[model samples]
Target chain A: MNGHVYIIGLGPGDQNLLTLEVLSLLPTLTDIVGYGPYVERVEVPNTVRKHGTDNRQELDRAHHALTLAQQGHRVGVVSSGDAGVFAMASAVFEAIDQGDISLKTIQVTVLPGISAMFAAAARLGAPLGHDFCAISLSDNLKPWELILHRLKLAAQADFVIALYNAVSKARPWQLDTAFDLLRKELPTDIPVAFCRAISRKDEHIELTTLKNAKSSMGDMQTLVIIGSRYSRVIQPLSDCNPWFYTPRSITKK
Target chain B: MNGHVYIIGLGPGDQNLLTLEVLSLLPTLTDIVGYGPYVERVEVPNTVRKHGTDNRQELDRAHHALTLAQQGHRVGVVSSGDAGVFAMASAVFEAIDQGDISLKTIQVTVLPGISAMFAAAARLGAPLGHDFCAISLSDNLKPWELILHRLKLAAQADFVIALYNAVSKARPWQLDTAFDLLRKELPTDIPVAFCRAISRKDEHIELTTLKNAKSSMGDMQTLVIIGSRYSRVIQPLSDCNPWFYTPRSITKK
Candidate 1:
């Protein structure tokens, strides 16, 4: 028997941002698997069995999804935001490459969603309007040295930098260290934004200068966007929120 | 009369990728303004007037949308991908900042959508599984020299690079020049993908090594993804399409 797996991104917290491609597949899913919160976010029919796992058990959950699919069941592996960016799609592929699962009997399709960076950018006004890079500040998967190196180089290149997982319980001090490292290469006046729970009721966007950035401003759910030298702020008029944007311009052609 | 303008991202070329947030706003909009193709993609009631403008007239289109809103029409200015990423959102803000318009006269809200990079990455396994950056190769708005400098620095940072507007008539040689500069630092075998018209009926994806990359493989509509040193390929078993991905890992801690 042959089965299939659909890796779907749920976007941020808002169901309104869910891709029609992913939404269309939900009713047909026999099984749904993901981190507990992400799996709960999907509103599927009663027929689908949901498997929620811990945040760190990606490999195990991927193997489980493949096993279910191999039993001729259609499964959906869910992730908040786009599954391909630091999410479940890679976890499934990594399992196959590591020999933890076999791809001979199962089909896989990955669907994209509205990522947090783009979501936050929309609310904050185009801080990533120019060339930009996104980096995970988590040291669990990579060395802190590498994170520091990339931050310095990104600052040097003047790429608008989006820092994901900027701070977590396991690595509370990393965000501070990163800000310190970035300060060496970037001007103190560069704009930095901390956006949390975007598109949700509790959503908050805070804009401050790099000189005024604080580690406490961000949590696991927060996405920190640091601007390049070219970035600017549009002061709020009366009731409007202040806008941060990088203008479309260049020094020479 | 008070009026509002919503700057929305339609998400790539597919109707399926359009956000429900943007979709839900359609019926409420009295006018829709964007590039011809993007404007055509919106499914609005007959009561809504659609204004399709030339590709180069983003600023004019934005100004029109704002003006229409100021006339008490609920207007939508649409972009193909996330509006904040190289799209109409920034142009609208630029207009506001340049004294071409006054924010006090109209309201603007930007709703995020799935970006092409995230969409392409989902289909290509997880090339952006780790840290990544997106840069537009078009030199019309920015200097060519700056593009080269950023590409070199992105290579040094080992970011999985997503190149947008890789090739256009106005700057046919930019893509080739960019590949040459990246080749100097990246290995010859680094994976590069050309994903064209993704999510549309004629969608095509091709993977090749950086050494084997050709400018002819891409056009204005194609997205070129360059894998970092950590990116890898998963060959198919039997007849399945090959998958490209990057594992979430690092060398040193």
Candidate 2:
């Protein structure tokens, strides 16, 4: 009996954004494992077992998925957005790296999906059209100072920056401090976008400048995009909302 | 006669990577406009008009799509990978910004897809699992100095870097010079991956350290990934292929 596990990216919340490959793979999964919210996103038959764990338990979740696969069960360890982008793919690899000898026979395949940054960028009219970087602002696995260092350098590099896990109830002040640090490296008028509940029914986007940005505006579900110097807010030719983007071509004087 | 235009992402080259929304929206389109190669990817009936143009004609292509939309045609302007990332979304916005009064009435929608970077990363075991940046090595639009400056900062910041359009026949030496520049900030042992023809029939992935990376190994179809200090090539416990990834959790010294 061959038991192979797939670490999959479930994309954001929209069903329409789900890829045809994942949609096909979901029906055949013997066990679906992931964070509670991410596990709930996969709708399979009741006979197919589902293991939903709390957030921050990625390593343990990965170990469980590999164990199930070793037992000849077709398992899927899922993550929100692309699994490779600050998600379960790395956790699975870390588990393998940590010397799980039983996992030797198990094969893991990762599937990419529409990340929150790109999803938000599309709806916002391409704030990340040029060179860009994505940094998770949560200091859970890494130090806060490292996060601060990367944020400052990314701003100075003039790359459009995407902030993931920017703030939660417990870490309310991180995003605030991030903006303050960004101010020293970038102009106060640089565009900032807070994208929340992306692709879900309650999707909302709020655009502001660094000086006007309020840290309280975002919750756990938000993705914050800080545009580069070349980014602009294009006036709508008609009654449509404002279109914003960083042009691809720039001729520096 | 309601005219609307959707600037859509075609994913890389796999039909399975196509989202449910774009797949469903395909048959309903009255026209499809894109670069010659991207236009060939969308297979609609002959009733729907298809316009395929040459490369480097982004502004001209955007104008044509908007003009068709203004003429009351349901138009879809297709882009390879996500439209919002180094693709057509920004070009469309640039067209609007550059002033085409008739385009004001035409509404444009940008849809997200699986970017080439994510697709290649998924196949290569999550090289972008941590903080990462994407840079286009092409100096067509931006100055070489700006690219070099950003590259230096990104390396110094310890970002896992993804290089898009890393090399081509017309500009072959850029990537070679880029590696020399990267060597200044990154260690010689840092891992670099060359992913070519991602999700296509000719898919190929070559792994090398910065010291061994050759510029001639890639072409226009390749996306080169430069791993950070923490990234590693995981050993296979069994007969399976080697896995590589940057661990999600890092304890900065």
Candidate 3:
């Protein structure tokens, strides 16, 4: 009964991106816990118990993990993309701080993985060369005003933006509102790339203009990459699919 | 004698992050060319010829690689991080565009790799959870004025910024100037993370204020991550290392 927890990033919906380090450690785990969809992707051994639920139930899941680890079980709490990036790592810390569970002596390690930003950037040439930012449109925890303010700032700065959790169940209009806010500051012709289910069987990537992106996007599995003023919509000779490139240069000629 | 060139990204220092799809194709190469420092980290077969050089000779190297590939040899032009993101893929494209090389018929494939921003963010917790931007302070390609303008926009928008190629041999003051511009708009207390040689053996990650970062960072290998206004600097209980977390929430409580 080793009492330690390893937080692993499943890496852009693909199992291959899981490091040899993470893969080697998986067998030692007695329990694997994460968001229901994410948990389904992992291949767990017969000895490992699995626990999963919707994203909102993360705190409870984390608390249960801490309790299980306290009882001398080796646990792995997993998340898609790097666990630290918009995943369960911080919530685990917050839960610890809130005194929901007291496992001060427990060993916790955060393993890195390929984020959606990198995966999306790769799928669409190099839209994240010089300066870029990623924002989530879901306003469940924060106010929409703040998201608007950040979007405005990102657009004005001419930063390639990677929008995550762009659309969700309760927040259907959030992505539309974000698109409208960005359209005001950024040129309507700016390239907006939508990469859905990256590195998965249902993978789909499309490059469109910000003006037309709202009508084309839906749900949580999508990631929207808005190119800066310097980003170009290049037509590669190999593929009919439009590719985006953010030049290293900051200024226009 | 099949003439074809494949530009590949080895991914942030670690050989493991290289896609299995890319790794499986490595054995087919006759020659691999890249910057000396970047190529040294890769583990390829002895049958593959290796050509390495400094950064200044990129154009020359691209021409050399194109020549070898045109001579009916399988050539792989290697780059760290994603090949398209500030690497040699564009140089090869530019060389073809210059009409000096008739590689229009030559097959070219740009493979993706993990970028430094993702590796850095994964190491330092989730500063990129919200909207963020990555800007290079290098004045080699653009004027300082444009760099300042982009920085100002990023600051005003409150996007976490990942600054690449921040300091170099000839341009020492560019980073300082960029820092000064950002300091004016962002609070002095905002957390700034300096990650050097990420995923490499000599990696160093430190958390400090934006005001103090200029003096602490080194040359080209460093990546300066400036957290947005929403980013919080928290000391993770596992290690003394300070982690930065950008909340998904728009409003600060």
Per-prediction DockQ scores?
A: 0.76, 0.83, 0.45
lDDT of 3 by residue, B109-224 (tens): 66666677767876776677666677777777777777788789878877788888877878887787788888889888899888888888899987888878783376678888
Q: For model 1, how many clashes?
A: 0
Looking at candidate 2 chain A, the ten consecutive residues that score lowest on lDDT are A99-108
lDDT of 1 by residue, A15-107 (tens): 988878888989999999999988988898889999999998988898899889889999999998888878888889888788633564478
Q: What's the distance in Å from true for residue B121, model 3?
A: 2.7
Question: Which whole-number lDDT from 0 to 100 does residue B165 have in model 3?
Answer: 83
RMSD of each: 1.5, 1.2, 3.0
Any runs in candidate 2 off by more than 4 Å, and if so which? Answer: none
Candidate lDDT scores, in order, read 0.87, 0.90, 0.75
Error of 2 at A98 (Å): 0.4
Model 2, residue B223: displacement in angstroms? 0.5
- iRMS per model, in Å, is 1.4, 1.1, 3.0
Give the per-residue lDDT digits (tens) of candidate 2, residues B1-253: 4488898999999999999989999889999999999998898888989999999999899988888888889999999999998898999889978865666667778889999999999988989999999999999999999999999999988999999989889889999999999998898898899999999999998999998898988988999999998999986666765777999888866
lDDT of 3 by residue, A87-114 (tens): 7776665565555334555666666666
Interface RMSD of 2: 1.1
User: Where in model 1 is the C-alpha error above 4 Å?
Assistant: none
